[model samples]
Target: MSAFSKALRTLSAMAIALAIGVAASFTPAHADPNATLDRIKSSGVLKVPVMVGEEPGYVKDPATGNWSGFYMDWANDIAGFLGVKVQPVETTWGNLAADFQANKIDIAFGLNPNPKRGLVVDYLSVPLFTDAWAIVTKKGYEKKTWAELNDPSVRIVVQKGGTMQVVAEAMTPKAQIIPVEDRPLGVMELQANRADVMILAIFDAVQVSKQIDGQIILPKPMLINPATIGVKREDGNEGYENWLTNWINYQRSLGLAQGKLHQTFEKAGIDLSMLPPEFSF
Candidate 1:
C-alpha cells in the first residue's frame, strides 16, 4: 500500500475509536434489575419507617417502647418473604421523602401519593387500601355537607403537610383552617372546642373520635384516596417493584390485606360498624 493511503487508514481508525469513546461517556448507566433485591438479601435487613400517634397504621407504646400496627404487620410479611429481618425507623409523615432520598428507609406503607413526592420516591401503582376523608366533630354540630363548612366561622383542623390539609384549603377556603403539626395536636384542638371540626381520613378520624368520644361524619362529596407503598427511587428496580406489586395483588385478591385492616381496627377498639355503610377499604 502507498504511504499516503496507509496514513489515511490509520487516521480513520483513530477517529472511529475517539467517537466511540465519546459516545460511551455520554451514555446513561442502568442499574441491575435485582439491584434492590440483591442488596436486601446481602444485608439481611429491610428497613421500614414507622410513624407514631396513628392507630391501625402505627402506634408506639409509651410503657414498652415497642411498636405495633398494620404497617408493622406489612413490614413483617415483606421481610419474611425476602428472608430478611425488619428494621423499624421512626419517622414523621413530612420526613418520608427526605428519608427515602437519604437512604434511611427502604419502604413506607400507607402513603397517599402526591405529585411533589412522586419526584423523589416511587409509589407502587397498587394501593394498600382506599381511604376517604371524614370530619370529626362535637356532638350536635350536625353539618353533613362540606359546603356548609365553607363559612368563615367554621374552624377546620388538619394535620399540616398532609393531604387533609390540602383538601381543607381547597374545599373550605373561607373557613378558618388550622393546620397542626401532628394528629394529637389536632385532636387536642377539637377537644378544647378551639376547632369546630378536624378533617382526617376515615381510619384516623374513627380512632380519634373513639379517643375523645366525638362523632364521625362523612361530609358530602366524599374525597376518596388510595394509600399505597412508597419506596426509594432507583434505576432498574422494576424487579423489586414488580414483585411487590404482585404480592399486593395476591394479598388483595385473597382479602388478606382487608382482613388485616379489620383486625387492626378491631385491635384499636374501633367497631367497623361505626364507619359509613357505603365505605369499603
Candidate 2:
C-alpha cells in the first residue's frame, strides 16, 4: 500500500480505539447504579453512626474517647470496599430512627429490623448476627422461667423505642414496662433496685450486669433477636443494598463477624460457653 494510505488506516484505528474508551467511560460493564455507594466513594468517607455506649459491639472508650468494638471492625471492612475512610458518628438508640430519617448518618449497626424502621430504612437481607433478649435483675430477683416474668408485680425497664421494649411487652403483657433513655440508664435503675427487671440482648444483658455488682442474667432468654445493620431508604440504591448484604454474608462465611463477637467476649472476660451454641466461634 502507498505510505499515505497506510497513514490513513492507522488514523482510523486510533479513532476507533478512542471511541471505545469514551463509550466505556459512560457505560462500563461494572458500572453500578447505587447512589449510596457513589456518594461514599465520591466523599471518600463511609459515615457509620452507632449507639454511643453499647459495649462488645460499639463502644466509645471513656478514657480516650476513641471508638472500638464489633461495629468498628465491620466499618473498617466496609470502608475498604468503598476505598474510603470510616467516620464514626455518635448516636443514641432512641435517636437512631430519627437520625436516619434526617440523613444525619449513612449506616447504623446492631439494629434489629421491624416494620416501623423498615418504612424509613432498609435492613441487610442476611442477618449479621443472631442474639437473644435476656432479662437482668438483682441476683435474688431472677425469675425461674419466662412465665414468671409475666406477673403483675414484675416491672421491666427497657430502652425507650428500642426493640427490647416491644419484646418485653410481648413476653410479659401483664407486667409494667418502664421506658428509659438508654441502656446505661436502664441498668442504673436496676442497680439502684428501683427497677425489678431490665430486658436486653444477651450481650447487652452481660454488659449491664457488669455495671452493677449483683445483677443476674436469667438462664433462659426472653426472645431471640437476629441483628443486622441499617441504611437509609433511598430510591435507586437496591444494587448497593444487595452488595452490602452479600458483603455481610461473606464476613459470616469467613467467620469475621463471629470472630469479632468472640474477641469482644474475651476482652470483657466473659466465657463463650455462656453464649448460645450458634454464637460459638
Candidate 3:
C-alpha cells in the first residue's frame, strides 16, 4: 500500500478505538436490582439492626435473651409480611452504614436521612416518624425560640457524634456545646447542673424531662426532622425501597406506627400529656 493509504488506515483504527472508549464511559455501573429481596426470600430471615440498651426502640431481657420494643415489634411485623423471621443484629447508629455496606444487616429503621449517609445507603421517602428538635431544660431556662438560646453564656449538652450535636453546633453556634458519648451522660450533665440545656429529639426530650423533672421546650419555628429506613445501596434496590415505602405508608394510614409509638411511650412510663399540644406523630 502507498504511505498515504497506510496512514489513512491507522487514523481509522484510532477513531474506532476513541468511539468505543466514549461509549464505555457513558455506560452505568452494573447492579442487581432484586439482590436484597431475593436474598431475604432464600434465607428466610430479614436481618435488622437492634440497638443494645436502647429503650423505646430496642430493649433486651438479660434473663431470657429476648428482644422487645417498638422497633422489634415493627421488625416482626415487616418480617411477618414477608413470610420470614427477623434476625436481630446489634449495632450503633454510627456503624449502620458500614454494616449495610458489609452485608452484615439487611435494613435499619429510625435513620435520619442526611446527605452524607445518603451516599452510602438508600433511604425510603416515607418517614418512620416526624420528630422536632427540642431542649430539656431546668426550671428557669426555657427559651421560646432557638435563636434565643444562641448565646455564649448558654450551655447546651448534646449527644456527641449524633444529629443533636450537629443541630446544637449549627443552631446554637454562640452557645456552649458540650458533647457527651450517650444519652445517659447527657442526663448526668443536666442532673449535676453542669449543663443548662440538653438537646434531643422531641420524643426523647419529653421522656428525659419526666425522668429528671425538668421541662421540655420545642423551640419556636420548630425544626422538624423525619426518621426513615436505610438499606444497602445495591443493584436492584429499587423494588426493595418501593416495597418499604409502601409498607410504611400503609402502616401510617392505619395508625399502626403511631399506635406503636404510643405503646412505647406508655411502656417507658411517659405520660402522653407531657408532649407538646402542637406535636403530632
Candidate with top lDDT is 1
The candidates, ranked best first by lDDT, are 1, 3, 2
Pick the winner on TM-score between candidates 2 and 3. Answer: 3
What C-alpha lDDT values do all the predictions have? 0.88, 0.78, 0.85
Model 3: residues >4 Å from true position, as ranges?
Answer: 1-30
| Root-mean-square deviation of candidate 1 | 1.7
Q: TM-score: which candidate is best?
A: 1
Cα RMSD of all models vs. native, in order, equals 1.7, 8.3, 4.4
Of 2 and 3, the candidate ranking higher by lDDT = 3
Local lDDT at 237 for model 3 = 82
User: Which pairs of residues collide in model 1?
Assistant: none
RMSD of 3: 4.4
**Count of steric clashes across candidates, in order:** 0, 0, 4
CA shift of 211, model 3, Å: 1.7
Q: Give the Cα error of residue 247 in candidate 2, in Å.
A: 1.1
Worst 10 residues of 1 by lDDT: 50-59
